[model samples]
Target chain A: MFSIASSELIQIFRNRLVLITSLIIPAAVSAFFVRQHETYADLGSLGYIAAIVLFTVAAFGLYATAVTTLASRRQNLFLKRLRSTAEGDAGILAGLLLPVVVLTVVQVTAILTALAVVAGAPANVALLVVAVLATVAMMIGLALATAGLTNSPEHAQVTTLPVTLGVIAMASWVGITGTENLAWLKRLLPGGAATELTMNAWNGGVAVTDSLLLLAPTLGWVVVAVALATRLFRWEPRR
Target chain B: MSTTPVIEVERLNLTYGDFHAVKDLSFEVRPGELYALLGTNGAGKTSTLEVVEGHRRPTSGTVRVFGHSPDDRRAVRPRMGVMLQESGFSPDLTVRESVGLIGRLTRRTDDVDRVLDVVDLTGRAGRKVSQLSGGEKRRLDFATAVYGTPELLFLDEPTTGLDIQSRDAVWATVDRLRENGATIVLTTHYLEEAQQRADRIGLMHQGTLHREGTVSELTHTLPGVIRFALATPVPPLPLHAVVDADGKVVVESFELQKDLHLLLGWAQDHAVELRDLAAGPTRLDDVFRAINS
Candidate 1:
């Protein structure tokens, strides 16, 4: 499993698209947020903006990446071939997901660092770590769930679009609008937990109540998404 | 004969919704033998192979590889290798990386360089899988399948989309593997490939084993053709089991000598010349078509 994970990491790092999305996108988004912080002169305003940026990366990096990888692996019959080997289902799934998880972690760290340095904002390290972990798990589960509905590699991007768009809209609005009711509703959104967690972290202390609320939805999505993926995931490519 | 069968299937059945992909299939492949699964498209050949490879569990019945159930993949997989119709390497990974990665999965690993050389991909080892031509990619697929030095190998259309030269290269590697005491279960659309490589053939049609035996056994069971062209146009004859066409006559029979003698006497008495006379045995394709139709 470790060897498989290492090889997958190497392959993911070599992919130009994944590299750009993971490294370049977060930096650019952080720059945009820094400019907004200068214009707005409100610390709370930066938290919302950062949450939107983090949400976008979560969707693309974790969810989109997972679905695309699974679909392509199925199309190429990688999943089938893997199953025929000594590796069990868990090993195969973990190996395939390892690279995406690592990329998400790196991207999250880069974005948070940019927010702290460029925006002159202090970060709550412990809360940020929890948010990153939760967001990564949620996105992975969501991607696998989406993979169940995708028939081929071509449909991966399209199948992932609906969830991605929904998360983006809700997470972005909750961050930008700063509405209390929206924050409560964000708890139900796919990336809402990550948004709340990131915001709470930027506030320099863990908001235990808010973090716990986000955890429920985030963990709920994980359970549901993984269950669906395990049930519906086809080993072979569907014609 | 050895008591241990390398692969064994008992009443294996598979279904895709209402479609019966394979039904009541049973066979065994012993070590040092090349077994061919011969079938046309949609004949459940792939499904049968997949069942034995543990990719798909049988809807009914059972499959065992070397005394272990195929469903117990971990116990069986290390001793078996599979070459699927499709290559599964990441487009970004080089040929060397792909082979090396699979090698890590096996309990016994072959030297990547030696395996690549066997497939004649050593020169192109550094090339990305996406950059490889169709045949090169296939060679790479073959290379990876053998990387584990498995005791049993399942080759699903291993030579598909290859040039004649590449096809022969794959054939040679298969021969070497068999010589080294590996059991091979091959599925191919190419009748000639099975005729050349398989020690015995299993003909599958409509999700069932229509026939199973050596090539000679199948041909001997089916009708053989005897065709001859005449030097002069011969009058039509009301001959039994014979086809009289323009200046030629064809007789379908298992007794070649008796049919040839009868044909020669009829031509001579009618003052017709016989030229380009050819008497041959039946071909595998003939038997295949006869059974399938």
Candidate 2:
């Protein structure tokens, strides 16, 4: 798993396209919005801004990267080549996702640290951490599901359109607007619960029961997406 | 060399829904010999190979590698290497990285640099796969397959994109590996490569093993021919001879040596010059051609 992850990190992080999509745009967007503190009347706006930044990383960084990387590997016969090796199928998938997962963790840490320095730390820090971990699992699962639909690396950009827009747009909506009439929308969409949890983390610490309630919807998405991925994932290139 | 075969396939049959891809095929690759599996398109060779490689399950029959089923990949794959028609390397990885990845995955303990050296890719080690030319990529494929000097190696069109020099280098390496007691199972379009290298050959047509033997053993099944043009009007030979429209005499004989000696004596007695006299055993291609018929 480490060998596969190390090789994948070098190949993925080296590409200029991935660098811009996965890191630069997300960081830049987060920094720009984060500097606009006067626009927020409450200090809790810090976590909301941080949520937007992390949203881009999950969508483009982990999810899109996973889909394209897996699809490209399959198209080029690398997956088939690996199948002939001593690595099992589950080990291969874990290795493929490990680098992206690590990268997501690092980038999220950076965002949270910045929010800490600016807003003096979120009140419900434990809940915020759980949301980040849950979102990571969700993104990885969704990526595998999208990869099943992707024909090639080139096809990944288009195939990932629905997930990218849904995750990022809902994140942006929850970060910037009121939830008065859109209450159910927060639990219905894929990343909605996590976005709400992150955005509200600075308000106060939540009860353990409430945290689980907030996590259930996203957790459900992870299960369904992973189940679909296992069934749909192709070891060979699409015909 | 050991007497036991390294790979044994017994009455293997593979079917794809309504299509029968292989029919009761069977062959063995003995230890330390280069065995070539030659066939025409859709001849069941690829299907057979996939089953042996554990990529597909045979509809019936059994394939054993080192006395274990190929489906027990963890037990079998570590001891074997396969170079398919395409290696399917990730273009984003450098040559050295790609070699290392395959080596580690194959449980090879050899240093990555040494494997690259074997394929003459040491100079291009730092270059990404995308930067390498077509022939260079083929060499990379060869490098990965031979990473651990695997006990059993499968080469499917190994030299397809290689140049003459590179082809010679690959064959040289294969010779060295065979000398070290590695068993090689090859599938290629180049008949001469098999003719020169294989200790035994399995020829498949449609969905069955049409013939299997050493090159000479297979070639001897057909009659050899002697062709010559007369300087003047052609005379009948001591043996049964046929003349073509171009006025050239042709003799087909199972006993080519004795018949050719008699024909030489006949020409000498008549003082007739035998122009363009050519006599040799039938080639592997001829045996292959007979498959379609």
Candidate 3:
């Protein structure tokens, strides 16, 4: 698994298009949000800015990148080649996704740290960590499910747009509108509950128990995404 | 050496929705022997190979590689090497890196540089797979499959895009591996390769095993041929012969030697030149052609 991960890391850096989309684009977008943190914070709050930035990196950097990578590999039969080895199916997937997952974590951590430094630290760092981890898990699951419907890296552009845009829109809605009017409806959506949890962690005063309960919906998305992935994901391209 | 089959398939069937890609096919590849599975287009050789390689599951029946299920990768894969019909390396990775990654995943260890040299790709080691030509990519695929020199190897059209020299090099490497008692399962369009190297062969047509036997056994079922262009028709003195559309005198003979001698004697006595005279036993190509007929 480590061998495959290391090879994937090498390939990620070597491919210019992938590097631009997966790393540079997400970093640039996150940097803009950080640079304009005061404006976004005033519109909602520092917590709102945090949720948007997290979703930006998660949607583009981790989620879309993962989908494109898997689609590209499957299109070229690389996944089939890998399976020809002694590695198990689970190990092959873990190896392929580990680099992207770890890279996204690092990018999110750095951007969030910068946000904390400039906008004052969150009220609860531990709760914020939980929110980030849960968000990453949910996005990764969705990426796998999305990859099944994608035929090539080119196809990923079309397939990924709905989820990427939906999650970011969800974060914006939950963060800006405060979920006050339709709280249950907002939380029931894929990213809505996670966005609210991020806001409570950063802005505080939401109660640890209440924040912890937000995890149920996010974890529920994870379960649903994984189930969908199992049915949808294909190792070899259609003949 | 043990005489137990290295690979076995029993009543194997594969279906893709409504299409029955492979019917009830059964064949076994014995140890230390080269077993070539030859077939016409869409003959289910690939589907059968994929099932044996564990890339796909059999719709019904069992396939065992080295006494274990082919899907048991931990047990079966480490002992086998597969060269797929198409090159599947990452385009962004260098040839060396591609081989190294796949080799490691196979849980087999060998010097990457040495393997590159075996396929004459040491000079192109640093080149990314995207930059290599078609034949070069094939050699790179071969390099990875032979990395650990596993006990069993699957060569799927291993020489399709290769030049003659590179093709010879690949066969040389396989020859050396066989010398060390490696079992091989091969599938190729080149019938002569199978005729020359296979200890036994399984011929598939329309998703069934059309024929299976030693080269001699398969070829003996068909008559040998003798052909010659006659400038002046004067062959009413010996064995029966027919003129083809090409205006060449053709004779299909089970007793090739006796018929050839009689034709030569007749030509000599008549003072007739048997232009382009050729006589040979039935080749694998003939056996293959016989299938459709």
Candidate 4:
């Protein structure tokens, strides 16, 4: 399993698209903050932006990565070939998810480090830790959820559009709108939980109250996504 | 013969929504035998092979690999290898990486170098899969299939898109596997492949097994082609079952010796010499066309 994971990580880095998405997107998003530093007054605001950037990288790195990889593998009959081997279904799935999970972790760490060194804002370790865990779970769930609907590798990008766009909208809009009426709707959204948790954490200590609220929906999405993916995920491309 | 068949499909039926892809299919492959499932496009050859490989479950009936159901039991997979019609390796992965990953899935570790050598891919093992040509990539796929030295191997259209040389190379590998006592289930549209490699051939048409027998047995059962051009345009004889517009007699039958003797007698009696006379056993291609039509 570790060997399979290592090989997968190697291949993911070798892929120009995956490489660009994992590294370039987060760097570009972080650069956007550096450019707009004068307008952001507080460390909390900067941390919020960092959280949004981290969330985006996680989505692309973990969720989008997983769905696209699985779709392409299915299209190429890689999943089918794996099924023929001694590797059980779990091992095969773990192998596919390994690269994305590792990339997500690396991207998140890079973003947090960039915030500390370049942006001159120290990270709240406890809040950052919780935020990172939530981001990982959310992205993995979103990926499995998206993979359930993707029938082919070619359709992977299009099928993932809904989640990608939804996360961006939720993360970007919650800060701008600040409308009380939208809180309930945004709370259920994937990135909304991370955004709120990051905002509370960046202010001081861990936001126990906000983190607790986000946990329910986060866990729910993860459970549902896993179930759907297991049921609907096909090993072979439909002819 | 061993008591346990390497592969057994009993009254298997599969349907894709409203369309019946395979119906009442049944066959058994013993250890050390090369079994060919010969069919045309959409003839359920792939569907049948998929079921045996546990990629798809039969809507009805049972598939057993070494007396274990492939759909229900995961234990049989380790002893089996498969070469799917379409490959699904990461384009960025080198041939060695792909083969090495497959090797890890087996109980016995296969020497990656030796497997690459068997497929004649040692030189290109470091090359990315995307950079390899069609034939080279196919060799890579074949290398992965046999990497584990699987006891039962399923090859679906294994030689498609391969150059003549590469095809022959794959055939040699198949021969080697058979010599090592591996049971192979192969599906191919290439009749000559089936004729050359199969210990027993099963003909499938319209989701049904139309015929099943050894290559020689099928040839014996199918009609032979007796073609001859006459010196003079003689009256059509009963032996001239099918006459071409150019006045050449085409006779199709199993009794080639008797037919040839009778044809000679008729020519002698009429003082007409037969030109371009040819008599031979029917090929698998001929048998396939005759049965399908």
Best-performing candidate as measured by DockQ: 3
**lDDT of candidate 1 over A1-239, digit per residue (tens):** 77678877787778887667555665576567666775543634666666766777787777777787788778777677667678888888998888777777777677767777877664667766777788778788888888989987578768988988888776666665554775556677677767776777776555567566667888888998889988987777666
Where does candidate 1 chain A have its weakest 10-residue lDDT segment? A38-47
**Per-model root-mean-square deviation over C-alphas:** 3.1, 2.4, 1.2, 3.0
Off by over 4 Å in 1: A38-46, A118-124, A152-154, A176-179, A182-184, A204-210, B233-243, B257-274
Q: Per-residue lDDT for B1-293 in model 3, tens only?
A: 59999998999999999999899999899999999999999999999999999999999989999999999999999999999999888999999999999999999999999999999999999999999999998899888889999999999999998999999999999999999999999999999999999999999999999999999989999999998987775747488888876668889999999989988998899898988989988999999989999
Supply candidate 4's per-residue lDDT for B62: 89
Native contacts present in each candidate (fraction): 0.69, 0.75, 0.90, 0.69
In candidate 3, which residue pairs get closer than 3 Å at backbone N, Cα or C atoms, i.e. clash?
Answer: none
Better of 2 and 4 by DockQ: 2
Candidate 3 docking DockQ: 0.91
Top-scoring candidate (TM-score): 3
Q: For all the predictions, what are the DockQ values?
A: 0.63, 0.71, 0.91, 0.62
Tell me what TM-score chain B of candidate 2 gets against the true chain B. Answer: 0.95
Clashing residue pairs, backbone N/CA/C < 3 A, model 1:
none
Reference-based lDDT, residue B225, model 1: 80
**Predictions in order: chain A TM-score:** 0.87, 0.92, 0.99, 0.88
Q: Which is better, 3 or 4, measured by TM-score? A: 3
| Model 2 residue pairs with clashes | none
Kindly list the per-residue Cα lDDT of model 2 for residues A1-239, writing each as its tens digit: 78888988888778888778777777676666666654642533666666777788788888888898899889989899888887888888899889878988898888777867876777777777888899999999899899998999899999999999999888867766745568787667888888877766655545657656878889999999999998988898753
Residue-wise C-alpha lDDT for candidate 4, range B14-103, written one tens digit per residue: 998999999999988878889999887788988898888887888999888888888643588678778878777778888988888877
